[model samples]
Target: MKRLIATGLALAALAVPARAEEIKELNFGFISTESSANLAKSFEPLIKDMEKAIGIPVKPFFVGDYAGVIEGMRFKKVDIAWYGNKSAMEAVDRAGGEVFVKTAKPDGSSGYYSLIVTHVDRNDINDLKDVLDCAKGYNFGNGDPNSTSGFLVPSYYVFALNNVDPTKCYKRVVASNHEGNLLAVANKQIDFATNNTENVSRLQATRPAEAAKIKEVWRSPLIAGDPIVWRKDLPSDLKAKIYTFFMTYGRNGTPEEIAHAREVLAKTSDGWGPFLASSDAQLIPVRQLELFKAKVKAENDDKLSADEKAAKVKEINAKLADLDDQQKKLPSM
Candidate 1:
């Protein structure tokens, strides 16, 4: 029977007609970008539900970080995965992945913020400049280099602009995932860190004491939501079923059904309330940020002669401009 895993957990009475040769099993990759065990636990109920809805045995493929997940998709070890925009770009470029949809916040917004945070009791670290002033003495908790908000945003907006090399400035700098960073900051293991709004919100709800101990010092602009990526060459029918599993979840269902779906989603600390169909274009904004950072670095290269630097910066700026124009052409999510 075709059943949409919508809200309140009511199953559809009829099933989507099966194709001539349907996939009986699939490997769904989950990036332990945060806490692998915790993230996997949160998805357990939904994974089972998805398996039942799609009438296939969906295997959970958990990996250490974005790179592993991307490489897994590249090597065909993963059929589908959830990816941040930057890694999603990698998946598309190197892994033959295509974005079919993205997860949305409970308010239906398709974005979240990347924040600079510190211990609530650290009155001396009240703001960005303070963090920099204390940089030489403080132990820093930085995001993984591959992370978009964790690494890319802070690198582009904070360290690069200020001409500060974190590795040199901080007493000790530890690269950790969002969950690790958050916990480190909360326990005073690290003096400062970067975390996303989604995880922060979930922490506030699920771990109030830890959340209360952490405070946002600064935050980046809205980052496009995470995408559900799949191998581009997967058979169309299988792709359809996979798409249906997410897109149909929490939609077009009775109140009880809707509530049930919401309940299941609640377990995922990211406050994901729905899945919205999206395209690869959703990544253009972040890609533009990445390009802008490259331009910044190229312009500041001391090894290059003035003329050479100017020429390189000009080339990068042109690409940024093209992406900017392309971004404007896409519908606002």
Candidate 2:
């Protein structure tokens, strides 16, 4: 009887599941939209607020480029991140990331625009036509490859649609973040560069002298707001805490608290407000942009044989059509 009772107890213990380890810290990654010092200063208040709300150490992860943050999330070194629509799409597809919220404009605008900018002193280069003229041997500054406004939008609208490859369209081509590109243009380091309206507005507010030296040469259509993403496999309880904190951060609390939260948010790079509930679906428009860009590239490629190019174009068209259908079904934001 004693042996049987011991056997039963052992079996019961074997049947019980082990408790999962509790998360001790959260690492939030930020894309290198600007200098590290500037980004740290802008996000400090929000970071402190998040740490207090989540009851854990919240560390800020920064790198030289957007890809680094996506990779950090892929390896589970970063638990959350702020990603432009283009980078967020990459994170969702490559990393274990899912968009949980998105920044909202203070005035309730739905999106922002990508811009082509030049130094105000450059009377010779007034618009997209002059930049694309390619006879002046003008140097160009592009945005980070993964940036939506900085790279993708302008790449599609300015270069791709015009069938001019940026590498060959200028005397020199370089890649940098929005801030770097903006400052470069203002300082006349590069004749022109890709930037977005948000960054330009921020610079205008902070450094009017610099902003005054820059002029918009061209602007792309509206692009979706940036997204805040987290690892999909994060602990359910932790996810809940994070979700609650973000959804309520600036939108909730007393009048004083709300004002403070709004001020902190306004200091950030893009000067956005309380986050809105978002999901992977928020990336649909960006995905469509990507597909359209790909389609244009496929159509423009000169090396491919007639049949090969035709087949590739057909495939891209199919993808674009699918995206269009998906977009039609989603509720309006």
Highest-TM-score candidate: 2
Candidate 1 stretches with Cα past 4 Å from truth are: 1-22
The digit string of per-residue lDDT tens for model 2 on 189-297 reads 9999999998999889878999999999899888878899998777666776787788777777899998988898888776878777777898988888788888888
> Could you tell me which residue pairs clash in candidate 2?
none
The regions of model 2 sitting more than 4 angstroms off are 1-19
How many pairs of residues collide in model 1? Answer: 18
User: All candidates: CA RMSD in angstroms?
Assistant: 5.0, 8.9
Clash totals in order: 18, 0
lDDT agreement of model 1 with the native = 0.80
Q: Which ten residues in a row have the lowest lDDT in candidate 2?
A: 4-13
* Alpha carbon deviation, residue 108, candidate 2 (Å): 2.6
Question: Which model scores highest in lDDT?
Answer: 2
